[model samples]
Target: MQTVANFTPNSIVGEIEKVLDTYPYNPYQQAFSIPDIRQQLIEYVLVRIPCADSSCSVESSQENTNQVPVSKIPRTPLQHQLHLQNLIHQGICVIMQMKSELISQILCETVQPVCEPSHWFG
Candidate 1:
């Protein structure tokens, strides 16, 4: 087995070992081929996206700024909360509407042939 110090992050085996460390299960439980292990690990790990502010740098920015930068748009706590609530409400409404329409379509198809009066149901 290659030593950790000798391992480079570029190789799939090394990446798999790093990912395995994040989980509680024994890393050696199953024999893993480099490509499959790499693919699975990459799929599971979340990718970070940069914030919307064009001037913001992920590496240099502080966790929270005392004042918003000139390029960034600032919002009051209440405004931010309300914006989030509205977005969530709209998303839920869209999802529920789609689900209801799909269910209605399936019910219509299943009942169409069995109904004695298709024209009345339609």
Candidate 2:
């Protein structure tokens, strides 16, 4: 896997902007790619976006000499909980952004000059 040592905030914002720019502006019907865009954004946050800390090992298991002597896991339930919350937050943020983008596209489409559909009927 290629590491993202040089990832910057501007690049992140650029990616979001790129998606927004390409988004379908049709307000009467939803964009066919909106669902795909959502999935892509979610995947980008969960997988493609690199972590700032390369030292942290998500798969590292700690040995504990405690009560039941069960197999050790990489992370605690609390960590997982926090991680899930973070993902949810990120997802919501992206969705909200898309909402604004969709609105912008709708407005832009509405403001543009309209043409008759005479070619379609003929």
Best by lDDT: 2
Across 44-68, the per-residue lDDT of candidate 1 in tens digits comes to: 3211111322223222244456533
For candidate 1, give the lDDT. 0.35
Task: Pick out the ten consecutive residues of candidate 1 with the lowest summed lDDT.
Answer: 1-10
Q: Report lDDT per candidate.
A: 0.35, 0.44
Tell me the spans in candidate 2 whose CA falls farther than 4 Å from its real position.
Answer: 1-33, 48-74, 103-122
The alpha-carbon lDDT assigned to residue 52 of candidate 2 equals 21
lDDT of 2 by residue, 5-115 (tens): 332444444444454454444541243235655555555544633342232232223343332112221145465334434553565455556676774675577588767
lDDT of 2 at 51: 43
Pairs that clash in candidate 2: none
Stretches off by above 4 angstroms in model 1 are 1-74, 101-122
TM-score of every model versus the real structure: 0.26, 0.32
